[model samples]
Target: MKVGVVDVGSNTVRLLVASVGSGEVRSLEEGRAHLGLGEEILLHGRIRRRKLDELDAVVTEFARIARKHRVRELETVVTAPGRQGGESERLLEVLRRATDGPVRVVSAENEGRLAYTGAVARTSVGPGVVAVCDVGGGSTEIVVGTALLGPAWVRSVDIGSLRLTASLLHGNPPTRTEVESARASIREAFSGIAPPAPELALATGGSARAIARIVGGAYDAE
Candidate 1:
């Protein structure tokens, strides 16, 4: 089946059109638009009208692209913005209007599970613990579990590159103090959570992939 998966995230709206079958999947198309919904919500405690309008436009475009690819099913998954207080309904409405498909808000735990599942599926491993880390705009999800069974533990921390950048880094290039402040804030946020040890650590999301590419000269799931 050809499915179009729409991710309505805090910093960006992304689309993935893929063909899934018995034991394999093929990517047909992928695209993303920076919406910055998290920045507004974190600062003002609600999604502003301007951001909503921008999101509507972007989602409409993504829907057009999905249609162009002739996907059999369209599903929109809303993350952090949809979990925000007093803002989920408005965000869901915008996505539904734009995609004309089923839109659902996934809780932080579900998000962690989804991330971990996707990451683990890409690995060539057996019945061993695999740790998956998904660093998004609004939150960072860490999941550890057996590859064949499922996640045994999931922790969603409220610290991410975009959130920290928006909240702490004010200058064009942040100063040393600003960098330290962001690091300390992230450390404090992760202080409460402890995840299980894993045989393999898989990093998902944009920042992790970029870092892997730069540091390792390539991206590797292992």
Candidate 2:
């Protein structure tokens, strides 16, 4: 079936159209609008009415794009914003009106699972243990498993780049002290859990891609 999926993330609203069949999904088209909902959430502890209206408009346009592509089904999924923001029902109502299809907030576990499967599906990773990390705007999801067995462990850390920046890094080019404070916050967020070692570790997210452009697409302890 040809399906259109709308991802409502804290940093942006994205649309992905694809053909799903025979255990594969082929991308047809993609689009996104950066709304920076995380910053609002950090400031107000909830999504304001104005932002909700903006979200509705974006989703409506995305739905139109999906129809233009002749998709059989269009579904919307909310990520960190839905989990962290207050008055989630108001958000859901707005999305349901805009897309006129399925709309729901994705659970943290499922978010990790989808991130793992989506990343691993596009890579040439072997059937050994693999780990995938998605650093979203309001949270980060980590999944560990093999491509064959699927995710065995999933965890979501409730701190991401946007939140950290809005909460700690006030300067445009954050000062050294601010950078260190952000690093310390990140460390504290992940201090509780230890993930199993994997044969390969994959990072896939907006921040990851942006950093890859500057750091040559690879990461290591520096």
lDDT, each prediction: 0.87, 0.92
lDDT of 1 by residue, 1-222 (tens): 888999988888899999999988899999999878888888988887788899999889889999998899999999888886366688789889999999999999999999998888887777878888999988999999987689989989877778899999998899999999998999899996888878778888888877877897345555
Q: Residue 160, candidate 1: how far off, in angstroms?
A: 1.1
Total colliding residue pairs, candidate 1? 0
lDDT for position 20 in model 1: 91
Q: Who wins the lDDT comparison?
A: 2
**Reference-based TM-score of each model:** 0.92, 0.96
lDDT of 1: 0.87
RMSD of each: 2.4, 1.3
lDDT of candidate 2 vs native?
0.92
